[model samples]
Target: MIVSITGATGFIGRRLVQKLAEGDHEVRVLTRSKENAKLLFPVEKFPKITIAGEFEWKDCIQGSTAVVNLAGMPISTRWSSEVKKEIKDSRTRVTSKVVDLINGTSYDTRPSVLISATAIGYYGTSETKVFDERSPSGNDYLSEVCRVWEAKALGVDKDVRLALIRIGVVLGKEGGALAKMIPFFMMFAGGPLGSGNQWFSWIHLDDLVNLILEALKNPSYKGVINGTAPNPVKLTEMCEKLGEVTGRPSWLPVPDFALKAMLGEGATIVLDGQKVLPLKAQELGFSFKYPYVRDALKAIISL
Candidate 1:
């Protein structure tokens, strides 16, 4: 199937595009920087990739079978007022635009499916509570942002099979949480972040990309699906597994207060988290390549 993706230059987007192209699917990258997208998916390397300019989003969507929305600002930063605005706007605004482009297309021409990325932040930080796709959304700042982000996506016509993936902490090499933690572990100074009791609901990058692919191709994948592994470990346990995989000791700990001081409101992402499970995905018979934290850590860190 032909797929049009927004934020095609992002971490998940990049991997998803490559996997889709490898499966002989035509991919249209609706991006702000055609040159950058070109560099990332060069014609010599990816002949099926079409780097659509900023103005060609509608044209691209009309010709595609599905559209994946992964565009968003990095939230792992100091949450100043301006940064917060950027974080919210980047997801909600871009998603609104994508929906509008899809809505404007004729029924026969518009994409049949829309797979959008929301985060587990939608459920807020809850160490005690377990969350599934059916759970109610939280009332935190990030929750509001995700709520608005998904609301914008809901603007798509009912004919579109909308799949909103509430992604958890992504574990992978080169990027995601591991890149920041692995260096400290390699130097033998790594430990759990914050209070260490927070739930660390995570998914292997490969599994996440596969989930998106499944959502894109399977009509049964409509509605909310938690993009997380079945096993949800606490931050302390996750750190222990990381330490084991990296051949280091989980001794030192980053205090919650210290992290709060450094990242401000952004600290909630690491200091507190919800235990999200892939209930919907499992119901649909989706398989996770790396379900356990220890094994997931080994797959990434060992590489």
Candidate 2:
């Protein structure tokens, strides 16, 4: 199968591309620069991969079996006015362009499926209950971003089978939330941010990649699926797990006011949390390798 992917150089995108390549699928990556794409994903070893610049969408989508739209600005940075606009534009504009290209062009050789990425932020920070695919979206910055992002993706032509994955915090050995917290945890400085009672929905990278692969192969897996572990742990539990995994005592806690002062509104992502469940994915026979936080933390820290 031929696949076209945007944000192919990003943390999750890069891993997803590698998985697809290993599965013997041809991949065309949309990048800002062909040179940078080559640098990120070497074409010599993986000749089935093609790297093209931004405007190559129409050409790249043609003759593809699937398109995974993961292009977006990182939300972890401080949300300045400019940064917020970049985040919105990068996701909505690029997605709109891809949808137009697929619907307007690609008629004869159009991809059969479109897998777009979203976030658990779609549910917002709910202190009361767990959110599933059927739950209504929350009203927050991240939720608003997700609302528009998913809307743009869903606007794709009715002929295509579209799947939106509302992803949670992805735990991985590389550059994810866990990686950044390891050093602090190792030094026994790890503790919950803010109140520590907020619920956190997360998924291991291996499971996340496999979930995408399953979605690619299963026609029944359409619509919104929570790309998260079934077990949702509290923020305090997460901190405790990290501390235990690293054999360090979690003796410190970062106050909500301090976080807000340092990160501004962006601190909401860490200080506030949502409990999300991958109910649809589980019903569709998707199993997580590390459903528990302790095991996931151990696996990542051991690496």
Candidate 3:
């Protein structure tokens, strides 16, 4: 399959490209800087992979079997007013551009599938309820961002198969929520945040990638699918598991007010939480290699 991807240098996109390349698929990446792309991907080894400048829409989408849109501003940064606009505009603009490109092009030039990225924040911050693909979006900042992002993505021509993966906190060794927590956890300084009662929907990086592959292969999979583990964990439980895996203690608690004061609205991603379930993915017969948080943390930490 010929796959074109935006944000190919990002954490998940980098890994997805590598995996697709290893599978002997033709992969084209849309990036801002070719030099950085080379530095990040080291294309010398993977000849099937090609990196090009940011979405010259038609140029990037032409002759591709699928287009995976992962381009967006990072949510981990402090949510300044400007940064918030950037976060919204980054996603919506890219998605709108892609849709326009596909619509403007001939049928032969357009991709068959459009796989877009979103976040589980679509379900909002819930304490105990488990949200699935059918769940209504919440009114929070992240949730609104996700709604707009997905809406733009789905605005592509009706002929194309559109699939949106509403992702959760991905646990990976190199980079992600896990990487940020490992050092503190290893030093026995990591603990639950706020009241530690909020639910955290998480997924292993491998599982997330595999789920994407599955979605690409299965024509029946469409709309929003939760890219998360079936077993959701509470904030306190996740912290305790990390401590257990690293042989540390998680007795300290970061106050919610302090986090909000420090990160602004961005803190809600950590302080407020959601219990998301990968119901559609599971029903499609996708199996998770790392279903439990403890085992996933152990594998990532060992790496």
Instruction: Give the best candidate by TM-score.
Output: 1
- Cα error, candidate 3, residue 251 (Å): 1.5
Clash number for candidate 3: 0
The positional error of residue 262 in candidate 2, measured at the CA in angstroms, is 3.1
- Between prediction 1 and prediction 3, which has the larger TM-score? 1
- For candidate 2, the per-residue lDDT at 11 reads 84
Candidate 2 weakest ten by summed lDDT: 180-189
Q: Candidates ranked by lDDT, best first?
A: 1, 2, 3
For model 2, how does the per-residue alpha-carbon lDDT over 111-198 read when each residue is reduced to its tens digit? 8899999999998887788899999988877889899999999998988999999999999978777876777776767888888989
For 93-170, candidate 1 gives per-residue lDDT tens digits of 899999999999998898999999999999987878989998998999999999999999999999999999999999
**Which should have the higher lDDT, number 1 or number 2?**
1
Q: Give stretches of model 2 more than 4 Å off.
A: none
Clashes of each: 0, 0, 0
The TM-score values for the models, in the order shown, are 0.98, 0.96, 0.96
Displacement of residue 281 (Cα, Å) in model 1 is: 0.6
Report the lDDT tens digits of candidate 3 across residue range 40-138.
877688888888876454786888899999999889778988999999999999888878777777898789899999999888887867799999999
